[model samples]
Target chain A: MHHRLDALLPLAGAILFVMLWWLLALSGVIDPVLMPAPQDAAVALWKGFADGTLTHDFWQTVWRTVLSFVIATAIGVPLGIALGSSSRVYAAVEFVIDFFRSTPASALFPMFLVIFGVGEKTKIAVAAFGAALVILFNVAYGVMNAKKTRQAAAHVMGAGRLRIMVDVTLWESLPQTFVGMRSGISLALVIVIVAEMFIGSTDGLGQRVINAQMVFDMPLMYAAIFAAGALGYGLNLLFLVIERRFVHWGGK
Target chain B: MTSHSPGSPHITIRGLTKAFAGVPLYDGFNLDFARGRITSIFGPNGCGKSTLINMIAGLMPMDGGQVLFDGKTLRETVIGYVFQNYRDALFPWKRAIDNIAYPLVRAGMDRAAIDARVDELVTSFDIGFDLKRYPYELSGGQQQLVSIMRALAPRPEVLFLDEPFSALDYEMTLSMRDKLQEVFHATGVTMILVSHDLEEAVYLADHVLMLTRRPTRIAEVIDFGAPRPRTSATLSEPGFVRAKAHALDVFQREVRRAP
Candidate 1:
């Protein structure tokens, strides 16, 4: 009984949240133009899906997010390994990495706009840049914290520098690398959506939200925002499944 | 293989000196490990036995001494070190078989040869457990067995075991001791083991080097001339008891004299 209650707790909380939102809308506590009723938003979601606009926007956002994530992973993994393996390399780049990591990628939109010239490339590049820094930081620390005994064992077994890096260092850092990848992908999706909403984009879930708000289509705006939230949650769940499969011995 | 006499030195440590934070551990220390024998170094806690073996293994550089292999240079010689913490020593991600195959893989052996070698070791040891399971899934004793197997994988001329069985339960320790004795007899590899347990030191070793505390030197070198393949029954034998008592006597004397 307790286990069943524990399992249903999240669902109960979600229902309660929705109930509170509906009550506020029905009571006229907030402007209906700003916060549409739950039923109106549900209708708008169904209509958008039927018209294929929601599907196109969803796929576009997903494509940009995946592309940026891949780019970030490709660059971040190797750089992180190198930096983590060598103290000299880490010291050389630590300050620069820290500076970029602390500076919000959104704040650099104007600079990105000028450099990549207001296109999909600019938005993708900015998201990829942010994702890369996150992954690189995680990967470096993972490498740095690779067990000393394992490395020594490899060394004593007559493994050379490069061989040890591949055999010992790389596998040791894998659990941490997965952590970085998951967070990196999430950040990539967030940056891509923000970029779509702010930077010039013709189609995306973000753009739909903006377009609906401009036309005072409150239900459509709320539906698009809900779609974005679902997308983030879905992507995060996907990464979690992958992590569980690949890094089974992570905490053990 | 060039056969040296039973008492001939395999590794010689000359004029060794080591210090930690201005306190001397080994000052002008010298020792010789015999060829093709199991030598156990037993001392009190924090006596630098592990440090000494680490230096000899070339895992840690000596402060001023040279550890010279009798006929081969350090690089030319293959060494295997089984760490005390088997959990950290064995790669958790790799399966038992893969961990055993690691040193062979490092030696650039072909896949077929590596598999054959691992299979031979597993068969010779008569290991009954599943080799496909990852290290974490194995029991503590099994994990240490995997560690020992990895060390033996390279067919190392010298195997350094730093308190290999200290983490095991009483039953597991006894079983591992028998397993270790079997390996030693089969391979005749020169084994240097460091232990905190005096009985374990006397049982596993053909020769026991008992050390004093810091500024450590060999307080006694007691030889257990008992038979090979020492069993649990051997632990009660007259020679084993005598050897253990002598080691304890030397250790007590050394501790009493420490300033």
Candidate 2:
């Protein structure tokens, strides 16, 4: 009975959150124009999908997010492994990696725009750049921290350096690599959405939300915000599922 | 294959030197491991019992040393090592069977031959648990058994074990000890075990190697030639009791001799 109740507890919290939002909307303490009723947002969501505008915007954002993530992963995993293999090499460039990682992707938008000239290339490049650094740091960490005993076991078994890396080090780094990939994908999505809002994007949830607010289409703006929220939650969940399936021995 | 009879030196260590931050742990250390006999290394705390074995096994780098297995370098001779932490020793990602097969794979043996060798090890171990299960799925004792299997997979001439049972409970330790003895008698593989527990050290060893504190030297090398498959009854035997007491007296003396 306790287990069943625990499962339903999350549902209860969601319902309570919706109730609080509805109550605040009815109270009218804030202007109705800024805060639409919950039903108005839901109705706008349905109508936007039915009219196919939201569907187009949703796919556009997904395409950009996935493209950048793929690019980031391609560059990150190998580079991370190469850097992490030797302690001396990683130490030399550690500060440079840390500095770029700490700086916000948004702050570098104008520089990217200067390079790529204010188009889709610029947005994707910026998102991929932010995501790649996150992935590189995590993958390198995983490789560097690969268990010493495990490596020694392989070496004692007559394995050469190349074989040890492929057989043991690669497998050892997987759990951490997955951690990096998940965070990288999430960061890519956030940057993609923010880029769409300011980089002159014509279609995407970010562009739709901003355009709705400019014309004071309150219900549409709320709907776009909710869509973005759902997308973020869904992507995180997807990566988590993938991580469990592949890295089954991860935390063990 | 060299010599199954005990007392023949299978490995020679000469002038082994190692230090931690300039406080010498071993200097000009020399030792011999008898062919086809169990040797348990015992010493005072921080005396480098594990360190000595690791250096001989080529797991740790020695500042200066020469180690030879039948006059062959580490790369030329096949060796197996069972680490104290079985959880860290066994590859969790691989199934129990695959973990046992890993050494064979590393040796570049064909797939068919690898399967045959792994099957032989499985039967010898009398394993009833599913070999397809991952390491984490098994009990602690079972995991350690898998580690032992993997070590023996390459059919190494000399097997090095670093406190193999320290993590296990008393009950598990007893059965693992029996299994090790069974394997030793059946195959006559040279076994080197490093243990802190004196009784455990003497129980499984044909020779117990006692060492002094750092800048370590051999305190004594006592040989207990009691017969194979020693059981709980062996613990109370006169020879076993005398050996244990002798080892304890030497151990206590060395502990007090510390600066």
Interface RMSD of each: 1.0, 0.8
Query: What DockQ does each listed candidate score?
Result: 0.72, 0.84
Q: Supply the TM-score for candidate 1.
A: 0.94
lDDT of 2 by residue, B1-259 (tens): 4653666999999999999999999999999999999999999999999888888888889999899998888878888899999888789999999999999987889999999999899889898799999999998899999999999999999999999999999999999999999999888999999998899999999999999988899999989989988999999999999999999999899889945
In each prediction, how many residue pairs overlap at the backbone (N, C-alpha, C within less than 3 A)? 0, 0
Can you write out model 1's per-residue Cα lDDT over A1-252, one digit (the tens) per residue? 999799899899889988999999999989988988899999999999899999899999999999999999999999999899999989999999999998998998889888999899998999999999999999999999989999998888888789889988988898899989889988988888888888888999989999999999999999999999999999889989998888887866
Candidate 1 stretches greater than 4 Å from native: A1-6, B1-3, B21-23
What is the lDDT, from 0 to 100, of the residue B186 in candidate 2?
85
Q: Which residue pairs overlap in candidate 1's backbone? A: none
* Local lDDT at A180 for model 2: 95
Residue B163 local lDDT, model 1: 92
Q: What DockQ class does candidate 1 belong to? A: medium
Candidate 2 ranges beyond 4 A from true positions: A1-3, B1-4
